[model samples]
Target chain A: MTQRISKYQRLKMMNPILQFFRFIYLSIKILIVVAGGHGGTRNIKSSTSSS
Target chain B: MAKIVVLGAGISGHVAASHLRRKLPKEHQVMVVSPNSNYQWIPSNIWVGIGRMKSKQILFPLAPLYKKKHIGFKQAKAVTFHPEGDVTENKPYVLVEGVVGDSKGKQEKVTYDYLINATGPKLNFEATEGLIPGTNSTYSVCTYTHADHAWEGLSALIADMKKGKKAKILIGTGHAKATCQGAAFEYILNVEQELRRHKVRDMAEVTWISNEYQLGDFGMDGMLLSYGDMTMKSHEMVEMIFEDRDIKWILGAGVQKIENGIAHYENLDGEKKSETYDFAMLIPSFSGHGFKAFDKNNKDITDKLFKGFMIVDANYSPKPYEEWSVQDWPETYQNPSYKNIFAPGIAFAPPHSISKPRKSKNGTEIFPAPPRTGMPSGITAKLVADNIIDTIKSGKEQLHHKGSMGNMGAACIASAGFGMTSGSGVSITTYPIVPDYEKYPKTQGRQLGKTFGEIGLAGHWLKLALHYAFIYKAKMKPFWWLIPE
Candidate 1:
């Protein structure tokens, strides 16, 4: 429970692999919203993505 | 004419009774029975707890409203239900006693062709040890009085902090099997806001304790909603905001005990920890008052029923979480045994919990919550009413309520200021409250900007209107049904 990874500083200085995965995740999220619009997009995508 | 006896004159009961009047002709009797003659707008208890609103503003007497509608009204708490014909099979009715303070109530036996047990829930203020007055352990917001008491307690705590004391304020449930994380989340933030306003935030520390696997899981699998290229997971979003406000949290932890100002918690990793709080408000776990009286064929009626809510054609099986899906939910909310008896409100149990419960290998109790709100309760009442009326008209039971938690959206406006001001008020709506994780896998069950980002003066006005609008409709004024369910 001691401090290991604080989302604050590390997010700004991410390793290549971590940065790559983050980009992919953000891209997918953006695509889902564009496909569904704000109202139903995330909810609709959630059903398929399986949260 | 089939007489319908509606139990509990709260939101569900009153709504059921009022709709029963419109659906059932003048020939049929629609009777409402409950201990409180007043209908309390429950959600506002938060304001009442914080001294923002008086109890009278939230409470409206139910007797006179029912009388004006020509509906039968009696103020009494229903203690028991004897469904069988008994030894002689002479008169079939349930015998109920009276609440001590209700003057119009007495020991009576009432028979009904159909009974809607919207008997809401029994507030167990003593659910968690030490969460009661005179115990000096913690505080609660289960009822108007409980909220008021919580407010008074917090005020005293604030005063102590002003006296140059470093104080720790903890809010949230001690039980993993608790729901209503929304309220806990709101209270902690409001307390932080209050502290900052008082210019003594530096001297006060705030923390949240819940049974959720994560901060905003809310018994529904965590949801991630993206707003303008920034994706915020519900749990992550809440935690982030809390951190920004300098509030801390303990997640996936169950309360072991609460003694005086000390709280003992067991974390998800089975690590036990203790924390001392200067003031605390811990929401308790909720359950249907599980009471069952058996029938002749060696059958059980209790497991099949909760409070007075009966499990209908619901696909209720003790399924593990991995196999859970929206298809497993019931489409029609009709009781298989008694077609006439319908339930709406907290009394009716969810087919399963939104958040998964993690029990010990030895099968001891752990996390529990099936998040259903007053909106769903009101909608369920409307749907149940429709089905009953359809049954009456067709002379055959028809399943008209096809809506389930899996299919419905929940809109909640959590008040921050109880007034219009800059940086005050929040209106949030979640689509398909039980997330369809398989569909939008990333966010679990959340739809972003389903109006969460639209928070401000307009939101404040909406909250204010809803407060009065709901109260007006509940009072059974003219054109009530036109006001919407």
Candidate 2:
């Protein structure tokens, strides 16, 4: 089943038009991650714990 | 009660100091020593070089910002480092030559419990002749004054071209060992853009001269794009773009001298030739300034340092390029002799050349720096501070830092035009640097994913917004903490 998924992923890159859209999709995904990221990987903490 | 002193006030210094402020105890003293009164985000200097931005917009006075953070600031240039205290006098301090205000060349001593020598590269204009005239010829844009003068020179050249006179502009570093080759590349491209926009590009001829083995090397030992071997092929990309704008290049050449309109260049094969230009902006090479820190024996520590650059906690040795393992590089930027001493940014030396360290026929060793662009350098400073603070608080050997330029992934967007489109910005990201020799034994720093530059409107917005966003963060506004370390 994993082999089939790998094969499907390889097949998707074969089409240039699809690949461009896929890239856009990936970047948009990354853009969301970037937007959501607090700028860096360092964990942020608050002085007064609310929970 | 540990007292720490940080030298310089550029991006790397500010990043280290600002983060150090948050990491250290309120009672623990923190001080910043620098020659400048303001903090300048130097990456935008390309725009400043082309007159797109003013010196005021790019720099902010460091005094007020330091005050708000309860941080002590000194506007002075350090002249010497006495790492080992003189037991005879019973006082230990670094002697500094004050350059700010009426001190205007007064010398003073700054004592510290721990010191960070983040004094960055020196713009050794004296390294090249005729490139900086009276004593030399061409103009420079390495600092506010240099950039200011370059802007004026560029405008004058533009005015001459508008009047139907021929103008030739030469842009590149003045020496073979210069870092920041990317900044020079950015300036030459911006100059080309401005000339074309003014419709005077046809009346002008622009040339680039550098010691880089190839264009776009940016000293990162060659990065890859999604396409493949981008470094080997970027010359074609520059050639295409240059051809489109009627620009030319004198690649793999080092500038020897500049006398008015003539520039003497040594070709890749070491043959010297002269090229004439109406205007030239040449970046200079760097040396460690051989700062003196002392050992218990009072032996001078200058020999351990690189010229103009401060030697940080890094393993220094000549490892073969084929054996260039990431493990050989630094993760935690702590000084080898003193744990409190950390060298971040250009001050810290990479273990070996990013490009295979080379030598001349006479065996003149040339060590090319591993390019640490402004962004990554800032990150390294933050990480170094974080680790130091952790060590201070825990009183145990804290986890060492590991922001290796070789293993780190980096992205750069070289602007073709300052507009709001992807077509306007040429951006590329490379990853898993130290190209997995096991996976791809033949290459170094090759890309696993596609490294492509998309030219569109959005890239321009990202670049401009980044300018404001980074400035906001550096100012340490309320949201600055939200912006990231």
Candidate 3:
């Protein structure tokens, strides 16, 4: 079955002006998520069991 | 002096060698042994498959870069693992066979103080009958050459469509347990847009066939994504995209064989079915290279080194799906038996698949294997390099540096179209790639805000920008280390 999407949402996805803002917004959001993942090593108790 | 050897020249191996060479002193040595002479930015292969980019634009020779960086390079493929010294050689070394030039077919024991097995999956196109690429109208995009062939086949089909010959196009997993659904997803979107660009949209029907039980399972059991002001399931987002583009889908399909222009598959219902297509590009199953390892006495000890892929510090106990935990994942990709050896990226076998296992009514297992590509590959490689550097300098065994998919994040930008202004992209950022039910306990075991999805032209821009950025980093350009994995 085909999915239903609001007409407004479809327009917004293609709107150059709105998409530019989305571009800026996504850039900042991704930067935050990616930065949080860096140097993300933690000291876990080494497992003893073998595969 | 210490000599570090890294196998394979893919993202993980290349990243590990680069970091090790940069961080370690000139006195120590860093060498890369790879069958491939060129380092290609794999993520950009999608663009090549759609004819938006060329193979040369995505690859560069590795010899010159290694020479300038003082990192040794060997154009050879590892044949056997000799973790312990043999009768003739007392040091831990790997037997590698040269692939080209005067050393072609020659075997040499490459010694190393520490070894990193980053050899990625072997594209098992043979697993599916009559699925050989460039034959029976089936194609692949797992490599640059494959992508080029796909584009050629597709362009020809597009030409036929423009001449009033209606066509059927199929894309998705070619095997019962294939991964890289995201790559196939990206390619389908690009192919759809390319058809529109060539003004043959109405002349061709595009369909997505996958082993996923539902749309957007993506081999990670899908995600609860925060899309703008709303929270939705990954399947919902994918369905909306496909619906808007008027694409058809076949789920729970285990493609068993391909014959001429027809694909035979068994569904979850155990019913046999077939789909006819004028052209197809399907991702094949990824399997281990079946590498054998031995001890100092030349006794066969392959089991100690491999269980399909290399054994790592993961809890690989046989357990049911509900009993699996993120803790079962590997933190340090070090081989337990040989502490001096490590297998990062796809080289390390996962304890279990992130997605729940499923079986066809006929008792055939069909589900996606875990994916260890792109971001995760780079991160794991860097961590392995850091731990090795620490161990070498401290003059002791060090397992300090660690990261796991259970806690690490990955950003996947699926390009729906290709262009600066008209292009569209679907961006999904998933934190702690493996679901942590105990930590989050809700929202599908992921932090909602961090695990978000967005669709717009910006996503395409980000993907293209990363294409150039990663190529620069791979070339070790000025201050390339400043870029994160």
| Candidate 1 root-mean-square deviation in Å | 7.9
**Cα lDDT of model 2 by residue, B1-485, tens digit:** 76778888888788878878876879888899998898887767777778888988888999999999988998888887776656653445778887867887899878887677778776677777755722233777778768877888888889989999997788877776666777787788788878877889888878887666766666665554443233335444555555555566666666667787788866556566788878888877776665666654677777654434555555566656766665565655676666566777777776666665554343433334566677566756776777667777887766445555444555565655653321244455555333444444544445445334343334444456567878998898875755542
Provide the overall lDDT of each model, using Cα atoms, as 2-decimal numbers.
0.66, 0.65, 0.90
Ranking by DockQ: 3, 2, 1
- Identify the candidate with maximal DockQ: 3
Per residue, candidate 3 scores C-alpha lDDT tens digits across B1-485 of 99999999999999999999999999999999999999999999999999999999999999999999999999999999999979999999999999999999999999999999999998999999998989999999999999999999999999899889999999999999999999999999999999999999999899999999999999998999999899999999999899989899999999999999999999999999999999999899998899999999999999999999899989999999999998888888999999999999999989999988999999988888898878889988988999899999999987666778887788999999999888989999997699888878888888899999998888998898889999999999999988877
**Superior candidate under DockQ, 1 versus 3:** 3
**Candidate 1 chain B weakest ten by summed lDDT:** B451-460
Ranking of predictions according to lDDT:
3, 1, 2
Regions of model 2 farther than 4 Å from truth: A1-51, B88-92, B133-137, B227-233, B304-308, B357-368, B420-423, B432-443, B450-452
TM per candidate comes to: 0.84, 0.84, 0.97
Clashing pairs in 3: none
Candidate 3 Cα outliers beyond 4 Å, as residue runs: A1-7, A38-51
Candidate 1 lDDT at B162 equals 86
Which of candidates 2 and 3 is the stronger one according to DockQ?
Answer: 3
